[model samples]
Target: MNIPKWILDVFYSYLTSELIYFDGEYPIATPVATFFNPTKNSIILSTSVSFYNKVKCIKQNPNVSILYSKHEYSGLSEKPVVLVHGSAKVHEKDFEKNNAYLSKLIEEQKETWKKEVYIKMGRELDSFIGRRLMDWYMLRILIEIIPDGIVCWKKEANILGSVDDLSKTIGSVKGDAVFAFMGEKYPIGIPVKLRKSNRKFLIENPTLNLKEGQKACLLIHSHNKYVKEITLTRYKGRISRISKTSRISRISTREGEIGEIEFIPTSKFSFKQGGILNSIRFILDGKRRAKKFLERYKKT
Candidate 1:
């Protein structure tokens, strides 16, 4: 792989177990759901990876094709991480059964993931999503194809798209998104309310093709516009109002203290509105912003 091992590790470290599938069909997902959260909320793309097709794709359609265009021949393709680029299958009749089986799969995960937590004075998991993932799970899916290839990117390299606007790790996202790409600038998604039974959140006329099985990148934006977030490439969405917590546990069991352990959190934020949004992309420009990010990493 052209990218460094540590850089690869950093990229993988940011991957939250959730899979972000891509497709162009309209959604056949469960209705929208509302989740509660108690924390302030808070995401890039580049081109040194691949210049031609990305520009081509962006110019071709500007939305669906552009996203696919970047993936057509990315610099990340030179890396070692396995890239499973293909389609997934959804078995509606099997959804309930799959959910039941997944419960067992989760129970099995407990053996490996089980860990004690010492919530800060007034913190509880329920305050987030409670125990059950109410909005999703019932929608059944089964990937029928395998990944076409493997890929990666150098976190420290300035080869891909504009590095300036991409956020490192400080974004929170809620709602659905419609994507579009411009020139060499990274592809952008316009956040919209996840559609559900309730019709409350007001969104303008949204564009872009999305479906239940297709994949999309979720960029969680921080309340502070300055700090962006690492991208979460997962299926368009798993559940609504998803709680993505930084589980850096400072355990104080019967023992005095056990220090801190960081655990990747889940997120599926919700909103009472839906539709298009008129908004600015984010952050610095290409060359200068990339220089700024390179400096920040140097200090660390």
Candidate 2:
């Protein structure tokens, strides 16, 4: 893996990255704190055993992609967004060994992460109360991703149809979005134009060969420079191609077909919504969920 210096810098310092993997068929995307293991030259991420769905997905299909596209307050200049196509290995059997490595990896980022969490929710993650409440998160599993290839670009090419001037769009969502579609070897994610159509969403010029009735995912999220305020929403939906004839009159007439993929969301999940009360509620709810997951883990 001959990754460039700039890309490694981003991977080493990035606060969070979006992890996309195949869940049997459709892509599932989630945000995760990433770490670089120089010894093994692998990307490392730890999650609670409670997140069985993600672990199960990796076991079912190891092909995955990690995208580092956000650059708000990381003390770094604007850099090309890096997308890593990789194969994943989940470390689950040896609880003690995995936990020790996770503990050290976590300690390295504890100050930075704790500072951000403190600013966002006025809570200390290492505090006594926090420790007691988040024990489930401490019962961890490690995900090691070995990169097969890397793609870096500042932004998506503006070859797709333009929706900048369209007055009436479809969905009611406004945030940075990462579009996921099946690639030759694995699911790939890229920054794309997101707009509304009817009650669903539309992505402009999906570049990849897509068909009608195919399943995909849209990750919509927003965050302030301070990192105190954030909101993320994930949509799992099926694709329907909007042909050239159905293209709106305002759409540009270029060489390629004026193509668009309509995303009809069949399910939705809001992982984070920033606010003092909301954060408190989320923490409390997480504690309960963690307890249940721990019980579930022990049983298995």
Candidate 3:
């Protein structure tokens, strides 16, 4: 499908997108830095070599979906929420070449990079320390997603809040959440209404394609209206039919049953905020993690 220019513009300016890839059992979504590489005619994203799960999944199942939600610090809240389904090509053949490509990409978006650094670290983009302490982030493996389909939600302006809410262990059930599962070739991602009770959550019927035992993932995230605070959380689990009848309406364009499903999340991750000590710990942990990855890279 030919991507509209407006969607391409969102790809360029959007701060972060939820990159959803299928694991062997279920779909998993993670927040990733994105770049619209015009030359490649694809969306380029880099993941740390230490993050083995994401890289491994892309290699196993090339089908992926990227949600460019304007609710985050993307600064384009007025624009429609866009979802892109694409086939991914992992570019880890040459680490140095990948690193250089990412460096140039970052340089082109220097101001945006600085703003994100300030927001996340409460500091300026200090190159010396960054080069020394953040080498793990630089030791990257790139993934390019060639667009196959693009869809948009034009009127989702109310989806903004502090990441603190959705980042909690028991997140706020309000706001928009994306549910993803395998489609024919590309994984399908669509926003669904979220409801929680105890540990298990409920979402209105999203699609008829979902099976009882199929693996799926739900991503709940938003930012404040001012675009300062952001929250992102993901839950991965298998699907089961809900026993009770549901009053929720169907949301997907695909023909499906109008009943609910029980989403028993086996695992979850919340992108939350921390204090100064936590930030220090985060960098130290990254350094330690980088050592292992770098050591393995050398052996290879």
Candidate 4:
């Protein structure tokens, strides 16, 4: 197996440096370098001649551990370390490859140091020292963790009162689900439907297809003891008032007989009404009319 040249260089440089570890309770040092083998998917250690006896003792026991120190700027309380409770064996091929990588890595380090010296020379004396004194080295590690499932905070509220599922409906109306303090006598069971005339006039037009499973207020008009719903849909814009003027003539009829009913929009029932119920009813009607307009547009 072959590893990238750049990665091999990094591995070699890290290996040659003395690795500090904890032996029992006291800190111990190991003057060994590591080399990686692609086939084994592990790193191999090369012990120095001076530490050869110490390495032999640890190899015999085969229950040693390795600890890596954290950079001062790591901002972590625990030092990065790994433990090994297994035996070790010498691999000649791995050792040879490690040695070659380490030699090249050391050369690269020398080049980097030379460049640093040039950079420092270009800066002010005080600035150069400040840069070297700064203690901030960032270290990042990547790990993957997958969640099993989600746990909702309010199970009952989510199933019954959650507005997430009705986002489309609320968004279509340009409104969000919110709780309002309506009077105790607020009618909650009334079934309101969208109407077509609502959209012809430039009112808040919510589409009928996006009906929300919630109660809305409506304006109920009573005339001649008969309910005739006149929402933002039925008489939109100034058209209703304008239509009233187009009458040919008004003829008087006998008493107790209906002559003619003049239809006109007054300020009392117009969209400008400052009542929450009226506004809700107007919006609902506009939504219905808007839906009809869309359907007609689709057919044409």
Top TM-score model: 2
TM-score of each: 0.26, 0.79, 0.76, 0.23
Worst 10 residues of 1 by lDDT: 34-43
| TM-score for predicted model 2 compared with the true structure | 0.79
Candidate 3 stretches with Cα past 4 Å from truth are 72-77, 93-96, 106-126, 155-175, 206-208, 222-232, 242-259
Give the runs in model 4 whose Cα sits over 4 Å from its true position.
Answer: 1-31, 72-81, 91-300
Which tens-of-lDDT digit does each residue in 130-236 have in candidate 1? 22322221232322222222222223213232232222311222233332212122233333333222321112212222222223333322211111122322223
Worst 10 residues of 2 by lDDT: 158-167
Cα lDDT of model 3 by residue, 86-168, tens digit? 78999987877997786676555534533354344313223677767676666778999887666555643222222121121
lDDT scores of the candidates, listed in order: 0.25, 0.69, 0.66, 0.27
Q: Choose the strongest candidate by lDDT.
A: 2
Candidate 2 residue-wise lDDT, 1-300, digit = tens: 666666777876567789999987788888777778766778988777657789989988998889887755555675567777789999987766986785565555434443354234324544687677665556678899988766665443211122121112222211268877676668877666667777788776533456788888998877655444668898888887655432433465344444566889988888666777887786677677767877876898
In candidate 3, what residue range of length 10 has the lowest lDDT sum? 163-172
Candidate 4 lDDT over 29-136, as tens digits, reads 332334344444344454322223344344343333222221122233322211111234433224335445534333434233222332342243236543343211
Model with the higher TM-score, candidate 1 or 4: 1
